[model samples]
Target: MRVLVVEDELPLAKLIRQGLIADGLLCDVAIKGEDALWMADATPYDVVCLDVNLPGIDGFETCRRLRASGVATPILMLTARDAVEDRISGLDTGADDYLVKPFDFGELLARLRALTRRPAAAGGTEIVVGDLVLDPVTHRVTRGGTAIELSVKEVQILEVFMRRRGEVLSRLQILEGAWDNGYENRSNVVDVYIRLLREKIDRPFGVTTLKTVRGAGYRLDEA
Candidate 1:
């Protein structure tokens, strides 16, 4: 997924960007709040890693303006401020989640996964269609009483399909939401991965939940 990292500190910003890229995310960096505002307004990012204590407009005002402009992309705020009021202000200004630094890369990755995998705030952690069950936290797949193993990318793609259940997802949408942005490979990778996923998660179990829509995209549904 495409992520915007808004941090003024050069070293820290690079670290966050590198970590996210390794996790298969497309990322952009902004060192100032104004830059953040324009970047956010210009691109359709899935998540924003916003720094709360920015030098210019600050995260609070930046977040407020983004929301005011009707941009609802998820925001994960990074802050050194530990006060309850600070977190409250972040949330009140439209940040979806907050992490207090210095934070673990694993935690940040997990939070990003949580934000983008979701179709809505009220969506459940487990996605089910037919006998297939996927646990987002554990990255485990199960059908009936048996476990199915998938590569991380496979799991991510399947999650997007399972969450929507029956909707056809275009290739570009799958790549945008399930894979890292700015990946250099060029091929029918999505179809290849989906076929591979079905070999493990569907065929062996005598289930066929993931289906391709002729001339359209792919869909996953109990029906």
Candidate 2:
């Protein structure tokens, strides 16, 4: 597998490169965030090892930019800071995984393997269907440039619809997608949430993107 190693620390960067190379993995090292961005855009590496502290933009901003640019490569953030907030920030900014500095090489390799095994992140954190957009990271939703507020259940329902935009989804399928195992599918909860989503995401925009597929369930059409 090929990887990009973005770290300003020369020794650590070289060591990582060497370690990966020994494992029969190809790696390209970048000492600056800008360089990393350019390299990542230019090359379709399987994974990226990004350091939080960098020369120009730092890893957080770099990660944010990478997602904004629609680069879906799995990003594994490396950092010396182990604070809870730092980890949260790294994830919020779009890093797929985080490894605290002074980590074991074995763990790093395992994490990389895990990330590569999973599907690459879907076109960054924002999911868009027609003019409707949902930012999974920010929990923000907008349609035709108008901001729409959604409840937890409503957001979950909308996400399900957006992910399967043109496909018809049964209530059971939607329930499984939106709720956990504890949610007893007894009432018309799915219908209620769909109504709420329509009120916010469709009515104001004068569109019926979300529709009831007769004899099936529901479908969200691309506008």
Candidate 3:
């Protein structure tokens, strides 16, 4: 998933970005609240990680503005203060979840996943398309009772397709869903990864679930 991280602490911001990237998430970092507002307005992000102690317009104000502008993206506030008043203020200002400082990365990831699934509560934690089953929480995939090992990026791309199964997704759409703005628009990386994904998920089972639409894009459906 794509995420926007707003943290004034340069080192912490870079560290969060790196961790998110390693976990197969596309992440953009903004050191200032104003910059974050601009970036969030321009890009579609699955979630926002806003630090409470920002230079100007702090996390609470940033979140309030985001909601005021009708940006429905989930916001997870990060704070060093664990005070009840601080937590209540954050929630009152439109934050979806809260995390204290020096938190476990695993817990942070879990919370992000939970927030993203809020809108699609009907889908639950696991996704199943035909014989293929994916546990987003566990990062596990299996088809027809056989386990499948996939790279982090591959799994992320697959999740996008699974979430919107039967819909045609252009290269740009896939890139936006699976990659950050850092990727070149003209790059053929999507095609390369799609090919690799097919080798693992389709070819082994003799199924053509992921179809290429000439002059359009790609679609994923039941095999």
Q: Estimate each model's TM-score.
A: 0.73, 0.54, 0.85
* Model 3 per-residue lDDT tens digits across residues 1-223: 7899999888998889999988778899998889889999999889999999999889999999999999999999999999999999999999999999999999999999889988878857789999999876677999998999998889989998998999999999998887786777866899999999999999999999999999999999998
Candidates in order: C-alpha RMSD to true structure: 4.0, 15.4, 2.5
Span of ten consecutive residues with least summed lDDT in model 3: 178-187
Taking the tens digit of each residue's C-alpha lDDT, what string does model 2 give over 1-223? 5689999999998899989866646678899999988888987677999999998899999999999999999999999999999999999999999999899999999999889767736546678999999874456899888889876567767877887899999999887666543358876888888888888888898899999989899999987
Write down the lDDT of every candidate, Cα atoms only. Answer: 0.84, 0.86, 0.91
Residues 1-223, model 1: lDDT tens digits: 6789999999999998888766656688999999988878887888999999899799999999999999889999999998999999999999999999999999999898888777655776677777788886567888885898787788878878887777889888787667654554556888898889889987887777788899898888783
Candidate 3 runs further than 4 Å off: 41-44, 104-106, 117-123, 184-186
TM-score of 3: 0.85
Q: What clash count goes with each model?
A: 3, 0, 0
Best prediction by TM-score? 3
Off by over 4 Å in 1: 1-4, 20-47, 53-56, 70-74, 80-92, 96-101, 104-124
Clashing residue pairs, candidate 1? Answer: 24-180, 26-181, 165-220
